[model samples]
Target: MPRTRIHNMNISLDGYAAGEHVTFDAPIGGAERLFDWFDGRVIHGVDRVDAPVTLDRAVISLWSQGIGVEIMGRRKFGPQTGEWPDDGWRGWWGDEPPFHTPVFVMSHYPHPSIDFPNGTSFHFVDAPPHEVLRLAQEAADGRDVRIGGGPSTVRQFLQADLIDFMHLVIVPITLGRGVSLWEGLAGIEDRFTVETVTSPSGLTHQFWNKNGHD
Candidate 1:
């Protein structure tokens, strides 16, 4: 069966997924102090990230290796030209994002298709979580589907208990305040079984799987 998973989700010790104020300059919470966890080595599968690709590049390629499409929130996808009052910012990935498969961004806004230098193509959807998941599964073919994040979207799928499995890296430092990833986790016990833990350096990795996505 095709599974929906959220992997390597980084969060702060104080429960902040991102810093309080974010601009292009401060995308991942100061990009240094708030994200010291990022510099740590990432182990993909049984091997560490030894590829020549950037971390973001590896994130897309490695995670989707056997997965369906990737899903992101409107905020994560950024604003399109003539699409927002503020400065028009496309995805941070520039012309060649690593995702070769069709990418789905969940939002109310729609723009013409974004064709990247690589075969990667992005599609904007006004659909809900379930609808997007269905489309992602198809795009994934028989592979698994992945829900990539920016806090709010993760909360949506986690709230509905639509996720199948997860891999988390609990970093060492703490953000006094910022966007939290584990908030609104009130009813997940009804659908998930939290299991397994690994201590790697200062970071702790945890895994969880759904009882079933019925």
Candidate 2:
């Protein structure tokens, strides 16, 4: 069955998934170090010539596997707030977005959909989590829907019990003040079967499969 999944979400040791202020200059906010271990090449199936495929790279490579559509928060789309300006800003990613699928961006403001030649299209909507998920699932056809996050988006899906699988990478750093992933999700592990794996790069990868889901 097609499932709702979250992948390659980097969180700090303090449970913060993103920093306090997200600006156009700093996309992930001040928590940039959380993704230091990430290699963008792996997402496109590129391998490093200097070294063999490591465990971390192997896991990160699964980010786009089986994903047909993505749902992300407005913050993940861009650094705009309260009525998008007429600046004609497409998105953080230029013409060719990494996601080669239909992406639904959650936002309160309405905007026309943007399409790219690489099959990446961004649709802006103001619906709740369940409604958005329904739209995404429909666009996904028979494939899985991925929840691309900025923490708040993922939290909403978790709160609605709409996520079937999650892959969280725990970096060993602590951001004392930032957007947390476990804010109101106390005892959320009870709903899933969690497994942990520590990579040689010191990143702990946690896989959460919703209970009763394969």
Candidate 3:
């Protein structure tokens, strides 16, 4: 059975996964600074190449390692709101979208599925986490499903107790306000065994895995 996982999500010290005031210019919200730990490595989904095999690179590489389908909030897909303006907006990812698998964008408004030149195809759905997961799993064909998120989406899955594994990088900074991952997840740690490793870049990599599973 394929698992539901979250990989390489950067969080602020105050537990914000995304900053406030998200716009086309600022994708990750005000928490854009949280990703300074990239260290010039080639982003796996976007660049599709590895830098040296350092911890940052090693962990970043896993973002695309074994995932088949991706389920993300509409905000993660883009900064669009209301009805989609036009077909012109494919995504923030340009022609060669990084995700080579089927990607599901959870949205309130409906839109026809968009397939890019690359292997990525975006399907817009207005469904809850479990229903969305079922659809993604069917499309994945037994491969794992990744929850590519904007905090709110991830929190929904967490609240549903549906995530099997999660990799969160806690950058050493604080965002006073934003969408937080831990806001309503009071005892989320009890769902998985927590392990911590500090990267050379001062980011703490926290792995949350279910007991007796990877």
Candidate 4:
């Protein structure tokens, strides 16, 4: 069976995954400081110019590995809500999205499926996590399905016990307020074999694997 996975999810030292207010102006809230560990050039898709390969770059690069389909909440798809304001708003990524495979956006209000030129497509659906996971798994065609998140979505899947693997990056900053990833997930660590690794950039990487899986 193909596994469901989450990778490179960054959280603040205080456990907030995003900031209090999220708008087009502040897509990730004020938690941009949490990503300072990554080399700016690598994240922005700039070609490397002799920069040493650091832990941050290595970890960020692992995002697309073994992922054939992605599922995300509507918030992660965009900053819009309640009957999308415009159809022209594709997503935060312009022209070409990073995910080349199908991405299912979880929304209460469904819209026509969107197909982009760069092999990235968006399908809007109102199904619950399990149903959406089934659809994503089918689209994945045996490859792993990635739960690309904005805190709330990941929390829902974690609550449903559907995630098979996860890589969480704990940044050394505190947002104080925002959606938290561990809000109601008490004792979630008991279900997985957790391992912690600290990078030279001061970020701590937490790996969680389902108890029975390798």
Q: Root-mean-square deviation of each candidate, in angstroms?
A: 4.2, 1.6, 2.2, 2.3
**N/CA/C clash count, model 4:** 0
Tens-place lDDT digits, model 2, residues 24-95: 898888888887767544274435323677778878878788889999999999889999888888988888
Encode model 1's per-residue lDDT on 1-214: one tens digit a residue.
Answer: 8888897777767767766555666656452464464544434443455555553424423565576578987666763323554444557776667566678988776666677767677788888899899888887889887787877788899887788887666667876777778788856666777764544445666667777555
lDDT of each: 0.69, 0.90, 0.86, 0.85
Candidate 4's residue-wise lDDT over 1-214, tens digit each?
7889998889988898877666888787767776676654324222342477676676677777778899999988888879987668898888878888899999999788989888899999999999999999999999999999988999999999999999999998877788899999999999999999999878899989989876
Model 3 root-mean-square deviation: 2.2
- Tens-digit lDDT track for model 3 on 6-118? 98888988889898777889988867887776753335643455445677777777888678999999998888789988857888887888888899999989899999777
Q: TM-score of each candidate? A: 0.81, 0.96, 0.93, 0.93
Q: Mind sharing the TM-score for model 1?
A: 0.81
TM-score of model 4 (CA atoms): 0.93
The backbone clash count of each candidate, in order, is 3, 0, 0, 0
Which of the two, 1 or 2, has more lDDT? 2
RMSD of 1: 4.2
